[model samples]
Target: MLDWLITNSWLVWLVLFLLLAIIEMMTLDLLFIMMSSGALVALFTALLGWPFWLQVVVFCVVALMMVLFVRPVALRHLRRGPREQATNVERLIGEQALALETVTDHSGMVKIGGDTWTARSSDGTAIPAGARVAVERIEGATAVVYPAAGPGPFPAQ
Candidate 1:
């Protein structure tokens, strides 16, 4: 079996390439894909009657080059777009809210976008309930807010 493998080494390279490709699909990290490219080169070298050791050396050099050079360019191109969108609590900043309770510098509550959140005065002043406020930012679980101009005077009821 060992003698047959030594003589038909291209089969080994082919099997290695397939294994790397399979792992690449599972990981999606581009590392195994680069290794599969090296295995492909080694496969060609084996078909050309190169010694097993020489094929291994070629595979190592090619894989290293791909990882160090090609992978960066590919990742940069793949990531070429607008910066990542803000998520979760970050989306609350700059929104307007209604003070659900008398919001003071130390503690308060506000209804923001249909959700009630703990809030604090941005300028350390009290904001009465039913007042309009703008979210300045978030600190931990709390919304920091400042008084927002009220809506134009209601039409005479």
Candidate 2:
């Protein structure tokens, strides 16, 4: 069987390629598949009457080129994607909510999107209870806010 496989070199290459492809299917990644492509090229060369050493050389060159060049690009393209943003602060940007707790000196707490968040007024003014506030920025777990247009601590007097 070994002598027959040696004499029929193309058959050896084809069988090796099939085995590599099977492994690739089991793994579901691209590394073995790229190497299998190089093996297939060598199989074609052997079928065209190239010497055994020449076929080996072709296989080595092709395999090296795939490993050095194509693999990085394939791995990068097939990598898992980043997750979506899903925090309360992420949802509060550009939204307005009522100040549940008073800000005596530009600091307080507010209920935005049904969640209470530590807050600070953008302008140096006190935010009173029942005042509408707009989210200006997120700092750590806190929300920097600005009082909405209307009567606040400084009523339009």
Candidate 3:
């Protein structure tokens, strides 16, 4: 049994690679895939009839290189969406809204794109009703805002 395991070491590496790849698919975090890359290198080394310890060394080096270098590049390319494509929440960040009532730092109401939202003044000052305002950011269920008259990088409605 022991001799079979020793001679069939590549099979072990192949199983490990498959297992790690499955885990990487489940996680989608790019961690186990890097390790699987190492296992693949070890499998190739075993197929070449290399010493077990040398195969282990090659695995370690390849895994480290993949984790330290390749993973970041892969994450950068695959994980993040294009900057211009905003999510539903992200789309509201710079949207213009109409103050439905006097908005202070504590509480108020506003209509953004025909939907009413809990609102707050960004600077703690009171904003009168019917004023045009820009959505600065969102905190919990509240929309923090400022007067649209001020200079800001946010787009106009």
Candidate 4:
């Protein structure tokens, strides 16, 4: 088995590629997957009858190239994704709500999409109950809202 392995070193590269690819799946960090690409190149080099030392050099260079160059581009593309990929909390921005109680800059409550939330007035003014509001942003567990145009910006509490 050892003699056969010494002669067929491509198998070693193939195994290394598989192991690294598996690690990439677990980590999702893009590093291990870059090394796996190097292992794939080394496997091809070995298949073409290259010396082991040359195959090692090829693997190292290719892996270094991927890590230094391709990884950043891949990360940027991943981050760019789609605009609609905003999270649920992010989607809450600009959504309409109703002031369940008087909403002041200090404390209040509002209902957004049928869900109750701790609320604050973005402009530090009191918004009366039953007033329509729009979410400006979420700070911690609180939603900051502004009086939205249309009905009942009533002065309640």
* Alpha-carbon TM-score of each model against the true structure: 0.53, 0.52, 0.64, 0.57
Residue lDDT tens for model 2, 94-157: 6777888885445798877667888888776888987888888888977888877764332121
Ranking by lDDT: 4, 3, 1, 2
- Candidate with top TM-score is 3
Full-model lDDT, candidate 3 = 0.89
Listed per model in order, the count of residue pairs whose N, CA or C atoms clash below 3 Å is: 0, 0, 0, 0
Cα lDDT of candidate 4 equals 0.92
lDDT of 3 by residue, 79-136 (tens): 5676578776677888888888999999999888867899999999999998888999
Report the error of model 3 at residue 20, Å.
Answer: 2.0
Clashes of 1: 0
Off by over 4 Å in 2: 1-3, 80-157
- Candidate 4, residues 31-138, lDDT tens digits: the string is 999999999999999999998889999999999999999999999998765648868778788888889999999999999886899999999999999889999999
Specify the poorest-scoring 10-residue window by lDDT in model 4: 148-157
- True-structure lDDT of candidate 1: 0.88
TM-score of 3: 0.64
Which candidate leads the pack in lDDT? 4
- Candidate 1 off by > 4 Å: 82-157
Error of 2 at 103 (Å): 16
| Per-residue lDDT of model 1, residues 49-129, tens digit only | 999889999999999999999999988877664334656777777778888899999999998887889999999999999
